[model samples]
Target: MKKILISGMAAFILSLAVPCAVYAEEYMDGRTENGTALSVQAMAVTEDIHRVVDVLKTGRMDEGSAGDASFWQLGAGTFSMSRNIMEAAQAQAPAGARLSSYTQDDLYILAHVICGEAQSYPDDEQLYVGSVVLNRVSHPSFPDSVSAVVFQRGQYACTWDGNYYREPTPQNWANARYLLEHGSVLPGNVVWQSGGRQGSGVYIRTRYHCYCY
Candidate 1:
């Protein structure tokens, strides 16, 4: 454990230091036999690249994988340094604990919770709801199984309000199966959600809930 922590910290620190190139240029100058002056050209290639990077960073980049990080330093001010560090950490990270251990019962439980929470929403949002449950099952802070995360007391209101017992729609079942097969449309760390923004960890929002880490 100590070795792993040290390695991770070392990797994180080293990766964070991978600076974004703010400036670059190539110039070649040679005098002709007559020593005539040649045309001067300045492309400002670095500046153009910097400008493009600035714009691209503000938009989404594989947000489904992004959800697990709780928050990303997306401010253009930080630039690619943070992006590289995140990639490093994810590369070494362990798979969600016991996520592959889920059974048929867990699938039904997931479908029921989706039915209770997001059945009326679009098909994707319904899958997002199911994804939240699976993300929790794999996260270190929560229980490690679908049924455990869904019924883990006060975590999901539907489990208590009798809504979870409803027969799930066909779409809900499909969403549940898709989650177990293809994984979340959300990130792996987004376990908390509410009607409005809840915390500093905000990731995305749907019609009925704000999902966050």
Candidate 2:
């Protein structure tokens, strides 16, 4: 999804157009993750269209929609219908997995931090690292947002290790998304711990990572 700049005049004209009718092209029709292409046999596309129409007519936006807010930001207050269309498109997407209320920047920052800190750990442990970051965000003690929590001084080694700037792998992305959507399997009370020492109370320990209150 590359960003494109639209001029005011063009945006004004587009705002007048009915979104669903104007942008009904087939999308995400590519091969699946398993490398199986869409069925060559002609399939009725009616059900999908009906879902889109229902979503649009109802004017209800679900949990998350791959940065739909940014798409409508250009027209701002002028394009309510257009926003519905985008939302509908998002709803109809094959992978309609709902995400936590975090924005794209939040997700990216989390993935980077998690990758930097626990890249060598197994998937669940990696998720634990991410859960720690998210936990801090939600907790009353730490900073409110992902960026704030991550950049807070003397907290994470990766922040100073130069690894925070490195690119995250695809698996890192998957792990991060899973954590964000489903949250930590560990108890919410279990918030802080380092790799080494077990603190006073009972701790959540798994593989190489250990978490405590």
Candidate 3:
């Protein structure tokens, strides 16, 4: 995977400076524009995407697949993943695991987490936070599912601070939907996230969140 430090908002902007073509693929097909295949986890799914759109339009989290991670990164300024766990995720997927089990419900849950964790940030910052969650789901070091990662104790303030149950705005839902449908060109290896205060190895920092590797 590409290794780089997401220092702050400026770095985040720089990362997005790459042309949109760099992120044109639908779902994680595991191949770049150059046709070089990379070993990524399986992300196959069969749910009607219209269902995901429905939730976004309506602000519901109870609609979809569940539970939640690998690699390490920080979001907002609170959550984090350890390196010990990341190696474990990689180990579980020798050639990389498939995410065929992921469902539209899973997609909604992810959006919920993103809304609770980053609804106030700029759209791109919210995308980066959502990317970290997807990164963990595919990584071997953490749990292999979305619900597990999201509900994991002490990982997200929204989960414990009661923000998770708060209904997401249409904008927040849209941001989450965008991330799920269009993978970030930024490093997917991010697995740890923090809020309120900064942490070491920070990759990107918005006004309220800090993403680290």
Candidate number achieving the greatest TM-score relative to the actual structure: 1
Computed on alpha carbons, the lDDT of every model, listed in order, comes to 0.59, 0.58, 0.51
Error at 152, model 1, angstroms: 0.7
Residues 1-213 of candidate 1 have per-residue lDDT tens digits of 733543354344333332212101111112232111111111222333333344345543345556323223332323344444344334432333225556799888989999988877789789778877888877778887788889898888898888888888898998888888777777666677788755444555556787765
lDDT of 2: 0.58
Question: Which lDDT tens digits does candidate 3 get at residues 57-150?
Answer: 5544432234101111112111111222233333432241234445787778877888888777777777777777777778777777778878
lDDT of 2 by residue, 68-175 (tens): 553344245334434544455445433312235868888899899888987766887887788778777777788888899899999888899899888898888888
Which clashing pairs does model 1 show? 67-187, 68-187, 68-188, 68-189
Model 3 stretches with alpha carbons more than 4 Å out: 1-101, 196-200
Q: Candidate 3: what lDDT?
A: 0.51
How many clashes would you count in candidate 2? 0
